[model samples]
Target: MIDPSENPELWDFLSSLHSGELLTGTIAAIEPFGVFVALDDGPDHPLFPGVGFITYPELSWTPFNEASEVLHVGQRVSCEFLQFDTWNGEARLSLRATRPDPFQLFADGIEVGQELQGRVTEILTFGVIVEVADGIEGLIHVSELAGTPCQGTQGVVRPGAYITVVVTGLDRQRRTVSLSQKRTSKGSP
Candidate 1:
């Protein structure tokens, strides 16, 4: 029997793949959490049909309701190689990393105390996450949710509701934007 480990071609192919390299592939499978890609003109994965893989968050810069909304089986894609997931024995790929980050753009154009309108995407005990722009969401802490103290986010806002908020803080490096729903006399600059 031929020993698969002894194949020089397999070693050469695996050796050629490096993190941060761009690779072209076809979607071999789609799961709730990620997508499996069959690399074009590349050696097959020892365990999977393709070597490239993209997690849910890495699938797109824009928020998606489902994996099918962004990718379908056999769809061609170009993705950035993040790393080789040793545990899963697959290449960790990112489709969003290949696209422009909307948060970066929003941060560059706005500043603290600026009033912006956004849609509430999620309501948590501590805060409400609002989508201020495409692919850009900001957190409105419980303290900032309203003028008066509230027991929880449910008292302040609901998902899909539109609200006006003031930019309270920002962390460009971390991609975090803090917003306040409390009404303020000061106007946005």
Candidate 2:
């Protein structure tokens, strides 16, 4: 079989035709709606001026008001091709598609007895959600927070605090990561 990498142009064109293709290009223009890119320094033409997508500004609220603020001309970005309009032949893409997901990260990096530092994201009656890294979140059950029989998660830990925790166990089959903040701390519960 011929090597696909031998011809970059043939690869991009064929790859674009396939669903779930990841395309990377430099942003050529940014309007209120979306940002456009120039694929492999390709010519600016109506048929294909690279791939573009209009993202809701709320997706990245703090730094962006419109697409222009989020992406400037000549910015590099990677996106997944979501779908192709069979009739109009326009390609749809999403930036969020690049994220692998929290549970996957947890499964990859965690081991029993390993210590990790994370920010508390959510506190619930059952437990608190601690975010360790981008897309990696784990649950610290109320029972695991302290030795005492805690009534609520707040009594054990507060949100937005950077807390050190330990991985007690992992249910790989269920994709759940069990952690304990009390075990990691110096003092006893």
Candidate 3:
């Protein structure tokens, strides 16, 4: 929804950009939620200092603890236009779109049933998250947790514990990986 309070002309300017079109800008501000970019060719924002924005997930392909770890204010960057932020009246850009997807690279060499060792990054009631490759995490569903019918994952695993898992599924369309711990063993991190 386009914010009625914002300038309509600004929205028009942003709508002119095509998705995946490369846009160059300098980091104008860094907020907890995302970064603001001062696009080289854009109107000055009515409310903000810049008319370009990059959300945290669009900033990088590699996982990080914070946006500061990957970007900083005043840093120049080239980002692919993702869409127009009608509500915010800014250009939504993706810095990661300018780079190759790491998940695709990891999937190129692997297939189903391949056994890989990775650290258990998270454990949920529904599944366990294992980091099988850089920026890639596979979900081991609760049903696939153990060989024998399992009770729960309460004391089964903890974060940072290395475990071996079989690649049960690869969803290229969604860019997701699914693993199973049923026929595997716990290993060292």
Candidate 4:
């Protein structure tokens, strides 16, 4: 769907690209929301400097505190084309897609009732997010966090503090893990 009335050359160029295809580009800009790529084979964007774009979550398969920790401006990279971003007139790209998905690689055999040790990454009023595995963050709902006492808990869960939790649920398609601090066996790892 090329808007030929606009930048016909740009639209035509993007129209030819397909999902899952590998595209090479340089990191043109990094914003808090996403990273921009100036694709080697793509036309100049009328607004953004690059026609290829990657959101924060697509930057890596590893856990990163910030996008700059994983990627940098001017760095060359090969990303998988996800789709044409019609709203932004850009190609939605995935840097992590070029790499193996950690969830699919590791979560296939994970079962409920498994105990895991993870560092608390975020604390919300509803629950805390923990990383039981690299790139995998799951929620310990407030209901699940109740009645669990830990050295790290001084009446509250704090980020970067370690906690043991039991797997309560898994959504493979969504790549989310549900955990319960209350269900974990008393032990430390």
Candidate 5:
């Protein structure tokens, strides 16, 4: 049996966790290797002498330009514990691997006709990806951006711009969110 007092730091860390612990930590450092977090302090401390770690596979699909962009020193973060891995002393952490993603908050709350304010994150030939809320990205297609028959999505909206839009549909399975700015200008869709 593992004695908790022998390794107080590790014990304290384990004490702060549960089966599916969701907590926030700050980025203490980011190396090409992985991200390190100052685990002791945050909105929720998951460990006593708080520390965080991120490996290669965990950074996938994080929308970070570089590993550094994924996190920065002193940057706060949110993640869930996959469960304690005593076999290897590896407590797998996931910042983007939560089930029933928190993003669904916006999806679940939005109605087809409800108006919303969204910030453009990326522009594609077919549509613009707007982040209506943190982790919640909705798309405004070329046709839905404007009713004037614009050239493309770029013609109607630009990245970093905020626009008023309407939720057209919610695809929970595919996680595809549909929005329309033109619907509001044209008086409802």
Candidate 6:
């Protein structure tokens, strides 16, 4: 078998790449899990069609139903090198890292006690997750779901249902925003 190390061209090309370097590539294929990119300035990957790969979450900051919604084959894209995935033998790339974080923008304009309308995206045993904006989700804990103590989240809220909630806490460091649905007549607390 021919060893990759024996190919000085491929070896030197791969050795020159470093994490956090910016790269340009064309979308070679779109998959459910990620997008394969044929790098314009890098050696061809032995296992994949392209030398760079972007995972689903790395495609964009906005939530998308399909990879095609964010990228198409032959499309040129700029990505940040996350790491060399030794297991997959591909360069782990992040397209979103090259763009501004939407969560940080959302957090900047929001404050505690501010009211916002959102759709329930998920219901967990501990709380209900609401999408206040594109890709922005906040949790309404079971205790904050109602004025009175509740037994469970089943009857409280369902997925796809729209609800108004007041922000109770914000942890920018953790990228978490705590919301509450319970409100008194005056909306003081």
Per-model TM-score on C-alpha atoms: 0.79, 0.54, 0.81, 0.71, 0.53, 0.81
Candidate that would win on TM-score: 6
Clashing pairs in 2: 102-135
| Model 5 TM-score relative to the real fold | 0.53
> Worst lDDT window (10 residues) for model 4?
146-155
lDDT of 5: 0.66
lDDT of 3 by residue, 1-189 (tens): 547455766877887899889999899999988899999988888888689999999999888888889988899999999998777888999999999898998999889989998889998988889999977999998877763346566777789998889899999889899998885654212
Estimate, for each residue in 1-189, the C-alpha lDDT of model 6 and write its tens digit. Answer: 225565556556656789889999999988777899998898877767787789998998888899989889999999998886655556779999999998999999998889998899999998899999888999998888863465568777779988888999999889898988885233322
Candidate 4 C-alpha lDDT tens digits along 118-150: 899998767889988876889987777854444
The collision pairs in model 6 are none
Quote the positional error of residue 41 for candidate 5 in Å: 18
Each model's lDDT comes to 0.79, 0.63, 0.85, 0.85, 0.66, 0.82
Ranking by TM-score: 6, 3, 1, 4, 2, 5
Where does candidate 3 stray beyond 4 Å?
1-15, 184-189
Q: Tell me the spans in candidate 5 whose CA falls farther than 4 Å from its real position.
A: 1-30, 36-53, 56-80, 83-89, 95-102, 185-189
lDDT against true structure, model 6: 0.82
- The predictions' CA RMSDs to the true structure, in order, are 3.7, 8.2, 3.5, 4.2, 7.4, 3.1
lDDT of 4 at 112: 90
Q: Write the per-residue lDDT of candidate 2 for residues 1-189, one digit (tens) a residue.
A: 324455445345544555677767676666555655565433333444454443553223133456765566787877666664433234456655665544665578778888888898898888888876665668988878764674666567778888888888888677667788878855232
Q: Cα deviation of 28 in candidate 3 (Å)?
A: 0.4
